[model samples]
Target chain A: MAQLTFRESIARGIAQEMRRDESVVFLGEDVGAAGGVFKGTVGLLEEFGGIRVRDTPISEQAILGAAMGAAMTGLRPIAEIMFSDFFAVCWDIVANEIAKSRYMTNGQMSFPLVIRSGNGGGLRFGAQHSQSVENWAMMIPGLKVVVPSNAVDVIGLMAASIRDNDPVVFLEAKSLYSSKMDVPDGDIVDTLGSAKVLRQGSDATLVALGAMVPRALDAAEELATNGINCTVVDVRSLVPLDTATILREVSATGRLFTVEENPRLCGWGAEVTSIVADEVFYDLDGPIVRITTPHIPLPAADALEDLAIPSVERIVTTIHKSMNS
Target chain B: MASTKVAPAQSDVAQKIAMYKSQFALRQFETRAYDLFLENYVKGTSHLSIGQEAIAAGVAAAMRPTDWTFATYRGHAHTLARGVPMTPVFAELMGRTNGLMAGKGGSMHLTSVEHGVMGSYAIIGAHLPIACGAAWSAQYRGTDQVAVAFFGDGSVNIGAFHEALNFAAVWKLPVIFFCENNLWMEYTRTSDVTAVVNPAADRASAYGLESIIIDGNDADEVYEVTSRAIARARAGDGPSMIEAKTYRHGGHSRADPGKYRPAEEIAEWMAKDPIPRYRLRLLESGVSESELLEIEAQVNAEVDDATEAAKAGGVPGEDLLMKDVWADGGAAWRN
Candidate 1:
């Protein structure tokens, strides 16, 4: 086993895909010489020539449009949108064109493309730059949304996303980009839509997404010391949500708490809450709780941003409240 | 394919006449489609390509059959010119089960992978970057297939148009930006809204691309201009643009009568209509009048048959709403 930072694992994962599939090419702003804003693409330009790793003008529409068009033909283009917030600039293309073209084309074309974007809010990049709007993308019907927690999951899930026969938006947690984690020694590919049970317990189930997974684990470990053991599962991909694992965990514990950075109302947490409400409501011994940020734009200040996001303390508090109430 | 260049002689003349006949067929098709839409036989509206047949027919003829094409809402002529079956084209507008898109895409979203009509975007200039992507794919896959993006004068002002052209030029993708400068961008004149005198080629040149302005109403000129660009792209010389000065005869949609257009301007363009002008060119060039009439009669019959078949076709099944929404994900992918 080798320890790798989240960003390094991303570079390794994409480099592996590009080596495996010639059709896989990387394109975006600062993806080339600048090696990506967070250095996720630090060594890609050297490994792959300019033809494969291109630095595009700051046009997200063109980037995504090219990805959609290339996917329609034979190329598997991995476009980086720099930040998930920039998805708004090409909102129509992402929401309307790329997401709907396959179904609109009647399964005649499989959009085998990946859009890697930096998401989440811990760094205090302010309102526009720091927003977790995976829920907005998840609302679109024909999209596959993936958000990984660690280096191992990021590498495997990214490779899987590149090979997926559908359009995928893989949002990397900017907060965890430098965080180091041990990944498997050799080649490892993770299955999409499969949730991993990071910890097991019977008191309650804590299903989280993106950076929230580590935080959920943190809360679980703290709860473990207090004798309130909990099960923690990384509900990785929201679109092809591992509802089977989610239902099983919730069924076993008779309680469900979804942790996320997005706002509470109608966010991804609501989707999980509704699913549990519909399918496994009888299995729950208590009401479903969602530990999420308030429904407001992310603040620029460090203190306010910290308070706005779902911290480990907040998840622990929500867990205890859900356990009792 | 035989040399795309058209000369004043035997087989070349025959190819020219073939293009002429195709333009006539598209003209007839658009006319009949508009009539059906007026009669309410075809559901929804259509942006007919009545005056812009030459650009469509010429560009489609200039490229290889395998080459991809993208267009805007005014794409019935484009699909027809690209050789999509008239039955499916008509059926698509009529929302039939056997339509080009299984009745899902309708007029604005008409598409056919087999015939190489990638998409007919309703949003102006939105498909430009997508067209660039197709070109990038062809280069990446090492295929000589070139993708053409067809849009109007209004699209030239949009950011996507600029973005796409820059990307195409920077990447040297095998794509052609065919600007159908039809003067009017849905009732508003191109000059009224745009900054330049003729928006054609100016935008392309801004992106450091080789561009040319041709008489869009002339089928032969369009074929010649687009053929050179496509050949250049195939030779790996990169992207080029052809701004074809064309006009739209009908109003923007079924609703508009186009009172905003000056009578003289519309009259001047109507005199410059591509079909009759090309017909005269063919006849003066020693092609018999009977040949032209025969082509017209044949297309007329084809349009009638298509209209009848489309009206007689069955509606989309109930599962239309449920199926094809998620090709590879959405719960089915869960393990």
Candidate 2:
């Protein structure tokens, strides 16, 4: 095992795919010589060279449009939008064109491409750059949505996303960039729809995604000392949701709580909660609870931003109170 | 196989004849579509390329079979020009199971990947950058294949147009941005909304490309200009933009009657219709009238057969509804 940061694992994952498939090419602003804005792609340029690793102008539409066209042809391209929130500038291409092209064309063409973006808050970038819009991509029909919580999952899931035949919106948490973990040596490929059960407990089931996974695990640890054991499940892929595992875990515990980093309104948690409520209504011990960031623009101030987004303290308190009641 | 040798002059004549046949095919196919729409056979709206057959014919004639062609919503002619059989084109417009996209794309989004007609986009200016991307791929693969993007004058003003142009130029991608300047953008005149007289050609300098404008009604001119541009792109000389000045014979869609244009302007353009003009030119160039008439008859017969075949095609089955949503050929999102 080797210790690697989430940012390093991103480059390692992309490099692994590029080495495996000659068709895979990557492009974005400052991804070439500059090693990406977030430095998530630090060593790609030196290893892959300029032909495969390209740096485009600050044109989101062109970046995505080019990637789509390239994907439809012969190349398996990975295009990056600098920030996740920058999707607003080029949502039409992502939502209308890339998402609908294969279906509209009746599978005459398949886009083997991945759109990678730096997503979510906890960085002091404020509203425009920090919003978690994984839900935005989850709603689109033809796209596979993935958000990895740790360095290991990042390498594995990034490989899977690149290998996927359909378009995948791979959202990487900006807050988790510096976080480090030991990943096994050699290629680490994982399945797209499988959610990993991080911690096993009996009292309550906690489903979390991306940045929320680590927090949920911490909360579970703290809740255990208070005599309330919680099971934490990391939902890696949102589109091809592993409802079998989720429903099984929820049914086993007979109580479920969602920990979401995204805003409360129609978040991915809502979808999971709805499915659990509908399918296993009789198995529930109490009403399912959701701990999420409030439905408001993320504030710039640290205190307000921390208060808005769900914290480890909040998750423990909510699950503890609900279980006790 | 027996070897057959032909002179260069004869080869040129053959190309011209093929272009003429393509033009005839587009005109007849579009005329049939119009009749079908009136008879309620063609469901939804259709943006016809009735009077602008020369551009599609000329561009297709110049392109290699492997070259990719991207067209707009007004793209039945462009699709047919790539030698995609009229049956699938007709069936797609009519929304039948045998359609080019199995009735998924409808009239506005006909696509035939086997024939290199990548897609027919409905959104204005969206496919320009996409075409550039395809061209970028070809360049990366070190192929002589070129990508051509076809749009109306209205697309010139969209942000994607400018972005695609700059992107292609910066990367020196092998793409041709072909703008069919059909005078009107829907109900309004393109000239009123556009800043320059030639929407595509005049803006070429901003992207370090030569400005070019052709008489879209003249098949010979379109063929020659497009051939040159294709050669330049194939030779790695970078992208080119061509503005073909033509006029649409009808309104933007089947719904409008096109009363918005002045009577005199309409009459002038109708008189310059590409079909008759190309036929007259062919006759004047020592091509026998009998030969031209024979070609027209063949196209008419073929179109008639295709229309019948499309009408006979059934609606799509329920199984196809949930298929092809993902690469797995199923729409199962949850396990």
What are the per-residue Cα lDDT tens digits for candidate 1 across B5-89? 3343233788888999899999888888888877887877889889999999889989888999998998999988999889998
Put down candidate 2 lDDT per residue, B1-335, tens digits, no spaces: 11112122223777888888999999999999999998999989999999999999988988899999999999899899998999988998888988999899988998999999999999898999999889999999998999999989999998899989999999989999998999898999888988887888888989998888778888878877888889999999999998888999899899999999999999999999998998887787889989988999999999999999998999998887888989999898899
TM-score of chain A of 2: 0.99
Task: Give the per-residue lDDT digits (tens) of candidate 1, residues A6-42.
Answer: 9999999999888998989999999999999899999
- TM for every model, in the order presented, reads 0.96, 0.97
Give fnat for candidates 1, 2 and onward, in order: 0.71, 0.76
lDDT of each: 0.87, 0.91
Give TM-scores of chain A for all candidates. 0.98, 0.99
Quality of candidate 1 docking, DockQ: 0.66
DockQ of each: 0.66, 0.83
